[model samples]
Every structure is written in structure tokens, then in C-alpha cells.
Target: MADDLKFSAPPVMRSHPVNPTEPIDTLPELLNHLHQAAYVEMSTIPMYLYAAFSIETRGYSQWDPGVGASRLIRSIVVEEMLHLTLVRNLLVALGDGADVTFYDDKFMPKYPSTMLHRSPPLLLHLGKCTPDQVRDVFMEFERPKPDPLDPPPPDGWYATVGEFYRAIEDGLRRLDQTMGAKLWAGNQPDLQYVAAYWNRDGGGKPLLVHDLQSALDALKTIVEQGEGLEPGEPTVPVDPVHPKAGLDELPHYTKFQRIAEGIEGIGTLHDFRTDPHAGDYAADAGLTALNTLFNAAYSYVMHMLDVIFRTSWKDLKPGESNFRYHLERSFISAMQGILVTLAETMAAVPAGPTFEYYALPEQGKQAHLIELCDKAMTYFPQLGGDNSVRWLLAKLPDV
Candidate 1:
């Protein structure tokens, strides 16, 4: 069934052109930009996660750079997730739902590709955690928009991720001031996923954005955590979540810089190939099965998110479980547990899992992914012996 499934590209979400130089004047334009923001945030996850998974922390001490590096990168990935969720919430607050486009050909970028709306295109790669990669791809992605006084990009596009988001922030404020309550006329409060469902210990909690103030707060957390304050600026005091964890409170750019500058050490890294593709292992059944399982699990998580964002929340009766919570648990477990394990295994194979689109027939319905999991167990018995993955898939929402 998995093999017979065809890859389908999702319908394009952008109905209007995005010109950063012009102010967003209409609700449709703003919604399109919000969709782009969600895409940018979602696109970085696999690139960062692949590197984090490649860092072999087995023999490294807690104080070693390798151990610290993995923890640091993983934490950034966590914050990125928060950023994505906040953007989704913002969309929900504004009457539009955010789409998870990672599993579609039209939406998901082929690695070594630039992010949406980024001019002078920064090519992101999926590879091992080498210093060169840290210095180049990761750092560049989080780089601050140089020269605060300079005008916006002449091409009407952004040069940095920070700049792209700054445009969105400016547009949101402008719209709120002008449109007033009518802007949120289609707002669905129940569709907004709140902080209670997110990781508080991660970068920051997911914020609920109903009004202008709350929306601004969400954007503030994203920008501050990503770019930090520019040089020569007074540092804002952060209430550290883990004071002893060292660098946990620092912005992502700072953390990546430290590792790139050799200020922090990293343990042994697997020789995983760069920008791997699913077709790279098509000749080997075992590797193919592993890759399929990994991609299927990934698609499943994203589909669950689409459901969460579009579907309204409802109360449950006695003996009935909340599918939303189940979906959330499945997402956390699949990313941290299943995906991580598969990544490490692929690294050991020296091939690496391709973060490509994998479609399952009638996706988001639960049964198809469970079937894929069963086949994966047949191919790789140690993937939580009998029914482990099946149990996980069973709990996912069927929307």
C-alpha cells in the first residue's frame, strides 16, 4: 500500500504576490504572508534535526562540546517548533488556518534550496554536524539583518529570515491599527493551540494570539530568540529556564556562533551524506523500508497538525479520550523518539534518511500509517518489537 501511494503536491496557498516593499493592505495578502512565515519556520526543522541526530553523544561527557552541541541544536529545533505553532495560532486568530506544507512537492523545498521570500538565496543542507556547516548554513539562517538603518531590499524581498519576519510583524501592526475588530471577525478561539499543549521548558511557551498585544508578544518571542539583540545594544534580561544548563537562555544565533567559533566542543559525528534523497536507497529493501517508515511518520505528524489547526476543539464525555491530545502526544513521540532513532540508525548506515515527501493513501485517517508501521516492524524487528508503533499510530486523530 505504501509503495502504491503516489506523491501529491498540495494546492498552492499564495493567491497574491508578496512584495516586501509594499505594506500588506488586504486580509488575503496578510494571510498569504502568514502562510509563508509558517513555511519558513517549518522548512528549518529537518535541516537542524538531521545535524543534531548525527552528533554521536554516547561517549561524550555532559561537559563535552559534542554533548552540549546536540542539546543546543535540539533546543533550537524545539524553539522552531514553537515558532511554527505561534504562526499557526496567529493564522487561526485572523480567521485563516495554517497549512503544513512539508510533505508536498509544490510546498516542500528540495534541500540546498533557499527559504521562501529570501533574496540572494541561502541554501540549507541536510548533513552531519561539522563546524563548516554550523558556520555556513545554520549561522546564516539565523543571521541578523545587518545595518539597522539601511532601507529594505531593493527587490522587494528579504535578505534574511529575521528581515522576512520583521515585514510580517510590521504588516500585522498596520492591519490591527486600521482594520480593528473586523480583522478578527473570523477568529476561531478553539482552533488556537495554547501554551498548555506546548513545551514550557523549550525556548518559550506557545502563545495564544487573539488581539494585537498577544499577537505582538508571539512575534517578539520568535524574533528575540532567533536573532537576539544586535551588537552594542543593551541585553535584555532573560528569566533562564535552566540556569545551570549554560547557554540555554542565549538566542539561537549566539549558540550556533559559539559552536562555530570552536568556543564549544562537539563529539564524534557520523559520516552522513549531505542532502540525501529517498531514491538514494531504492536498491536496498532494508534501507528503503527504514526511509519509508521515517518519512511516513513525518508526514503523519504534519497531517495531524493540519487537523489540529483546522478542526475546532470539543469537550469529551466519560470514557472518551481527546483525540487532539492524542495527536499532540503522537507528534512529540514521533519526532523525539521514532524519528530520532531512525536518524541515528541511518547515520550508522552512512546513507541518512531523506527528508522528502512521503504520501500515504487517505492520510490523516490513521489506518494507512499503522499499516506502514507494521511493514516497518517486519523489515526492522527492533523498531520497538510488536505493535509499539501501531499503538502510537492508533492514537492519532482521524481528521
Candidate 2:
């Protein structure tokens, strides 16, 4: 079980080395495929965060952190996260139990890498992404398909994340047909999840995937949001309950386009840097320190998720009352907000890497901190509402 989660998990973005001719037919291969799906989603988070965080907000008022560039890139990051959750849940529905791990030590992508090593032909840098980068490069990364309805590209290797998931979808269908109910032997609804954190970040409810239809919804949510297009379908996929944003009718690629092109009512035009900011992180002392803190915080978030999965799958426990269950979710929610702020802070501090994921050497210490916070929650009510997160933040070198 630990081996499955690892997925060669440590040096960052491990390769599956698939055999081109054969489909992902067996259970083990399916698990490996899901693990790769997790990697695909994991690969994007920091890259988009770095770009969004690097936007120049010198004279922006409506959107303080950023208006055009920041909003576009960050929104994609959120959806990428949604994509990751969907895949992890799918893994549990098929197998791996409810405690399946979502990520592992080598979860982070290197400073310069590619999505599935094919989505973008160019090497993606973890630096300040400029308007030109967004228009010329970033937009292309999530660029719409030449034909939205085009069939999945030839198997073996995928040129885009969509094509990759399309292949996975094909595998899911074939296996379901051959194995029938056996394919979803361990389907667990309790483990399923859908993230509706923001007004615009809606659609695709969490599902129990025991059958074909349910599985399709799960897969479709990932693909459609990533680059799905349905005529007469609103692009943003809003959760009617929270409609603060004017229109939620665009996919990730289109959202980036709005920033690259500009929304008439929102703001004025800007130029893509001819000589974009490489964000030479080593040059700045303070920014480097904050980035390190951000990386640690990011790893802790991963650790919390790891605990939640191992507790459920390995130890046979899963519930809101479970410390791992509660803290993992709470920490993620807290960290999401913090990430937005942290990304903004990185943007403010010029010439710095946004954050990078490294293996947390003292995971035991992290676990201890979670335990300490849990103890504080039970015995010491005066600590504050978010003692764990607050304590984690306090660990940074200085304010």
C-alpha cells in the first residue's frame, strides 16, 4: 500500500515508463496511472502559483494583490488542485481503500519541468512569469484544443493533460466492461470530494464511483474544467449559491486569455515584458527566507494529507472526529488562504522563487506539532481559533 502511494515518490515527478502498445488494463497499472494523474495535477500547482505570485501589482487598486495576471493564474491553480482531489477520490472508488494517499515525498516538480513532460514543449521555470510569458507560453500550456471535440490523441505519450486523462478514461471504460462490478470492488463514497471554495471555483460535486455513469462524471469534471467545452454551458461552472463573480463561464485556458487580452470593464491594457523577470531567487535575502518558509508550509500541508490517508487506509480510521481527518482538511483550508496571501507576498518581493516542495525531513516533528495543537484544542481553549496554523506560521524565521 505504501509502495502504491509512493509511485516512485521522492526525487520529484517520477516516470511511469508506460509500454506504448498496452493499455492500463490491470489493477496495478490502473493504480499507477492514478498516481501519474496525481503527479500531473501536482506538477501545475507551484508553477501557476509562481507565475500568479509574480504579477506586477505596483499600481493596481481593484485587485490589490493582482488584477489581471494574478487572478488568471491563481484561478487555474485552484482548479488544478480540484483536479488532484478528483483523481485521488477516483483511486479510492476503484481500490486503495478510503485511506489512499493523495501525495508523497517526491511530489514537487523540479524548478524547470514539463507537464507529463509533454503538455508544454518548453521547460517551465519556477520564476516570476511575465505577461509575455502568460500570453506566449502560459496560455499555450493550457491552450484550448484545436478541436474541442477532437478524439483523444494517439496513446503511448500524451501531448496535453487532457489527452492523458482521455486515455485514462478509455482505460476506465475498457476495464469496467471486462471486469464489470469487480472493477469498483472498493468504491468508497465517504472518501470522495469536490472543492467549492470560491464563487467561481464551483461545479463537479464529489461522487461515489461504483458504476460507469458516476465514473464518467468524475473524469469529465477533471477534463471539462481543465479544457472542456460545452456549447450553451457556462464556462466558469459557478455554484449558484455564491455568485459574487459576474460570470463563471470560462475554462482555464480562456481565463488566462482574458488576462492576456484584458476584460473591458475590469482594467486597462499592459505589455508583456520583452525581457521577463527570471526571478533570480538567490539574489534576494529576505525573499529567499520567506520562500523557504512557504516551502515548509507547503510540505506540512502534504504531511497533513498523508496522515489523513494513512490513518484511514493503513490504520482503518476515517471520520471528522479523527484528528488526522479534521486537521488535514482544516490545515488545507487554512493553507489555501495563506497560499493566496503568500503568493501575493512573493509577488510583492521581487526576484524570488514562489515556493518549492522538498521532502520534509522532520515529518515526525510535524506530526508532533499536530499532536500538540490537538492537545491545546482539548485542554487549553485560550490558545486561539487556529492554534496549529498559527503555531506553524510562528515557526518562520521572523515576521
Candidate 3:
């Protein structure tokens, strides 16, 4: 039944809004909660990417982009992506197939927005990598729990994201006991995103969520990685040379805190416009074209992800051999090579990359992406050097 659903299905109407403090007794409520988790993970990526991209890298070595801050923030972005993938697989395993329709207005968060249902809301902004932004927004997103001596948050809100996931974990255990085998009947292990397909080095390997324990393991990764450590876990010394070195590596919150407190040097950063949008550059042809190409490549990455999760193993025909693997490789290439380089180029122009909601057209999507590249090249000739654009585009799936 999920297969019959459109790749870009209209957003699902939930029975209730995602309020983490409330009970998730029913299957639908749990599914909706997981969807919100996915959104939370997805929403943070662009915000973090914006800050990472805004760092000025003119004097920095190519190997070390934007000095330590940029590298640190980008590393965290990769983990957030890992978090997103984990949440998506959890949803798919629970039978609510992947919904990568990021183009929809409802799914994408507006600039200067508060996170979904968070209490005492903190406004999220997309801008340069400043100490204030790092402390106020980035660190706050993953702020550790209050001192146990302090009072808990109001009844309907969670103190931290870790508390929220713990609640989800409790709900999953309850539902598993109540529903038994039927709860996991919809799980399709083959459809999960596992380590074999992910080529990147940082951010722990993708965990395949099949059963209840595996599901909880995935959630643990999300919480622990986001908020520095688990309760009672000693703080690991920051590895300046290799921050994301291992499982005990410094958590995201710590990384940002270091930069915010000047414990870590971020160097100079460009003051690009906050909350940039594709429409913001309408008067500037070059920016508009570059933004268009960047967005197309960005959207195509999401499309490829959707295709990977929804596709079946049996569908790999002669021409489609290792299609999923190719998609995985291309997705990484697009992010690291195409999107990263382009965003930096835009930053050098004193413009920020706008992560707007743009979907590739239903048909000939790959060809359209190539066309966008050519159009963008007219303004940003740096994009086509060494035929990297076409090389990356050639691996893109048409779907």
C-alpha cells in the first residue's frame, strides 16, 4: 500500500499535533511523533549548514575549510543528517514510509521559527557563524538537562530533547507490549539504510531498525549525540585534532559551546543576509541562477533518498543494477562537492545559500538538474571546472 502512494504524497493530516509530553498510546500517535522527530532533525540541517557556510575561508587551507569552526559545524551537520536518516528508517520500519517531500510549505520551517511544540520557545535563525548564534540557538537546541535540584519543565513540555526521546522510547515499549508481534509486522528490513550503503567516515554508521531493541538503539544514538553525554557519563576530553573521533567523541552541544565561549577559534565569518530565500535574489540574475542550481541539486538529494527508502530489492533490473548504491554515492557527492562548493561560492559573493522548498519536476529530473548547472555556470563559471558538475549530474537518478 505504501508503494502505491505517490513519491511526493500530500502531507499526512495527523489526528493531533506532536506534543511530546502527552502519551503516545496509539499507533497513529506514535507514527505522528516519529514524523515530528524527523522534521526536527531535517529542520536543523539547513540552519546549521547556513552558519557553517557563512564562515570566511579565504586564507584557510582548502583541507581545513573555515578553520576549526566551519569544520566542526559541518561535522555536526553530517551527524544531524545521520540523525535524520535514523529517524526516517524508524518511521519506515514502523510502516509510515519515507516522506521526503521537503518542498511542501507545511513540512519546511519558516525562518526565525521556533521548534515544533517546544516550550519557552527559542527562535531559530539562519545566518553567519557568530558566538551569539552558537550559544543562543545552536547550543540551546541540544542543551543538557537542568541540574536535578531544579524543577522540571511544565507538565506538557520536555526539559530537553533527550527527555522527549526517552518518552518516545517509553511509548514504544508500551505499544510493543500491547500490540505484540503485529506492531513490527510492517517492518521491512531490506528497505532500511544500513552502514554498507553509507560511505562517509564521520557520524556513526546508520543503524537498521527492525525490532524494538534496535529501534531504541537508534533513538539512543539521536539523543546522546545531540546532547553531549548520557546521564552520569563522564565528559570525554575534546580531541582538537580529531573532534568526531569515535563513539566517545565530543557531542554536538559541546562543540558549539566551545566555539561560543571562544574555547575554539572560528576565525572570521562573512555577514551574509539572515534567512535568505530564493525570491530574495530575484533582482540579481547571478545570485538567482546560483540559488536555483543549488536548490535543484539539494532537492534532487532528497528525491534520491526518498527513492532509496521506497524502492524494493527485487526492482533492481539489468540497467538498474546497484541503483541504490549509486544513489547513495551520488547523494554524498552532491552534498560534499556540489552543494558545499556552491554554498561557499555564494558566501564569497556575500550571499547565503537559501535552502528553500523546491522539488524537482516529476519527469526528467536529472536532465533538468544538468540544465540548471549550465544556466548557473553562465554566471558562476567556477562551477563547471573539471566537468565536476556533469560528472555529479550523470550519477543522479531520473526519478
Candidate 4:
């Protein structure tokens, strides 16, 4: 059982590698990607929390399909929290601040109806539902696709989340070749350093800056230099491609605009891959496969949240005032439920022969959770409501 699994405090920091010297021809585009990455990370927290709440309050004893799902979900949630922090730190390093304000209920990221094609009907109806109902809606949000290679349209782009990362990697390489030294000479210390790290790691070897041991050292450089921490440092020196040595740079776009662009780019990338006839713009090559992997992983996490939210809300009768306190509270509860479900799912991995068929190892599970968390946290602060309110809501009673 996942309950028997030990819980431990997550590491305070981790290393990420990037190439600082590489020049981005489209600084706005690159920044847009970063913003989208951050937004996804931020969006995941509420779902994880809701899952944890459902498994604990609703009682996992009722479900016999899996054992470690809840524990895995918990671990993933914590990691998602970590990812959010990491992305925020990166954004800060890049001279950006995420907006963490709540808006009207209508403002939530609308799950495209097309994305829910294969999803259970119970998971699809979340229009103005109660807190529990909202949580249930998320239960299917994170369910793994049986064949991630063939993702549904609108949402399924590339092949996996790993493929998405690959696109970022490719973009960084292009930026390096195109922008060169001009990219590194920027006053945006964080962006410069990240470029450097990306340049060094483009070859695919794990860079020192990305290793756990070197995280603090890299962070110190980022902080002292007023740059965001690069996940990894680049090994190769950047080539000077710009003819003009010290061009006065234009003032970059506002933080909000940067974020919006980043999110849009990600969406665009997804559209490119999922649309069979996207043609030249389609993510047929380069980092499209990585983007697909990223989407799959992201979808899996959301599916878990949907399950917990639906189950929990359905258990509660209609007309409950619990829905009126604060919509953010509901978001938090749903998040806890997601966490619990993750933990339980992971715990159950070793219990059946199905595990062999899937070939999902324990370490892979941890890494997947961590990756998902990192991806989701980037947009958490941009969410509505005070950080305290968000935190308190996440810590609410599971039921």
C-alpha cells in the first residue's frame, strides 16, 4: 500500500543546464516557450492536491484496481510544487515576475472539448460544478493514454513530453547559431545564463550544471550575476556571429506579454503536431517528438486529477455551500486529491503483472513525477489569489 511507503522532504534545489552564449534570433519566441513551460507547471499543483485529498478523505479502501497510485500522485504533487518554484526562480533570473492573481471563474484555462475525446463522460462535465465535482473533473485529466503515440487532436501534439523538451533544445541550438555572442551580452542576466546552459547541453550529454551536486554553485552564479539559475551550464564557448559587437538592445516586452506569448507558442506547437495535414509547420521533425512526450505526461497528470475530482464531488450531494467559500479552495482540494492519487498509483505499480507489461520502473516514476511538477510550477504565481490563500487551500481537509 502507498500508505506504508515512507515520505521524505524534497530537496530544496536542483540543477538545470542551458547554453548562455547562444543567441536567440527570436528572443520573444524563446521567452514565450519558457512562459508556456512555466504555465504548465503552475497549472498542475491544484490537480495533485485534489487527488491527495480524495484518496485520504474518500478512503482508498474502496478501490482495488491499484495500490501505489495515491503515493505516486503525492510524490508527483510535491515535485510539481518544486517545478513551480524552479520555473519561478528561472523567470526571476530572466527578469520576469509571474502574476499570481485570481480572476473570474470563467478565466480558468479552458480544456478544449476536442482534447476530451477519449475521456470518460463523468470526467468531461465540469461547468460550474461544486468543489468535489471540480476535483472529479480532473480525475481523467492525468490518466495515461494507452497509446500516447496517437494522441487525440487539439491536445495531442508531438508524441510525448520528452519530445516537447527536444523542441526547446532545437530552438536553443538555432538561437545559438543565429544570435551567438549578442545573445550572451544581454543585461537580462538570467536569459544569458540559460542560453549558455542550453548551448552546452545541446549535444545531449548531461551537463554538470544540471547535476544535483552543482545546482547550488550554478544558482550562486545566477544570483550573483542577477541571472536566473540555468538548469545546466554550457561546455562549448559560443561563436561570435553578430557583425555589430555591442548593439544597444531594445527593451523587452512586459512580463505578462512574454508569458502569454510563451503559452501561445506551446499551443501552436501542439496544433502543428496534432493536425495531420499541418505540412511544413507541423512538428514532423526536430523537437516535435519531445513535445508529444511532454503533452502525454502532462495529460496523464491532468487525468489523475479528473478522476479524484469527479469521484469526490459525486459523493457529495448537490446544493452544498462548500462550493461558495472560494473557488480557489476548491482548486486546492482538487490538487490534494491529485497528489493522493499519484502516490497510490505509484505504490500499486509493483503489485501486478501489468507493471511488467508497462515496464515502468520506480526510478522512472520518480523522474516522471519530478518532470511533471517542474513543468507545472512555472505558472503557479500567475494564478489568482494570494499565495497564502493558495497554500492554505492546498492544505485543506481532503474530504
Best by the TM-score measure:
3
Q: Per-residue lDDT tens digits of candidate 4, residues 267-383?
A: 111011111111321333322222322233333333332222223222335666533233334444444344333323322321100000111233444355334443333423322
Candidate 2's residue-wise lDDT over 1-399, tens digit each? 222323333343344444434677887677777777787777777777666555565344464543555555655676677677778778878877443444454555555554553422445555445556566656656654533554544446555667667778888888888999998877755545533243254444444566777777777877777664543344745422233466454677666666666541123223222223325455755555455545656766665555544344223445535443455555556466544554455544343443555455553645543444444334333333443344544442210
List lDDT for all candidates, in order: 0.71, 0.56, 0.74, 0.30
What does candidate 3 score on TM? 0.87
The TM-score values for the models, in the order shown, are: 0.86, 0.72, 0.87, 0.33
Give the Cα error of residue 349 in candidate 3, in Å.
Answer: 0.7
Which sections of candidate 4 miss by over 4 Å?
Answer: 1-25, 57-67, 93-156, 184-399
Q: Which has the higher lDDT value, candidate number 3 or candidate number 4? A: 3
Deviating ranges (above 4 Å) for candidate 2:
1-15, 58-67, 97-105, 117-120, 146-155, 194-203, 230-236, 239-248, 264-288, 311-325, 361-364, 367-399
Clashes of each: 3, 7, 0, 123
Per-residue CA lDDT of model 3 for 1-399, tens digit only, reads 122222322233232265554788888878887877777788899999999888786334345432477677877888888888888888878888754444455666557666654444566789788899999888888877754654656665665777777778988999999998888888887777774444343456688788898888788778777785654454432322224645356688887877898766777788789888888899999989989988878877777777778766555777656766766776788787788887888888879988876766778998998898888889887777575776667666677
Residue-level lDDT for 384 in candidate 4: 22
What shift in Å separates residue 133 of candidate 4 from its native position after superposition? 12
For candidate 1, the lDDT comes to 0.71
lDDT for 163 in candidate 4 is 31
**Model 4: what TM-score?**
0.33
- Model 1, 173: alpha-carbon shift in Å? 1.7
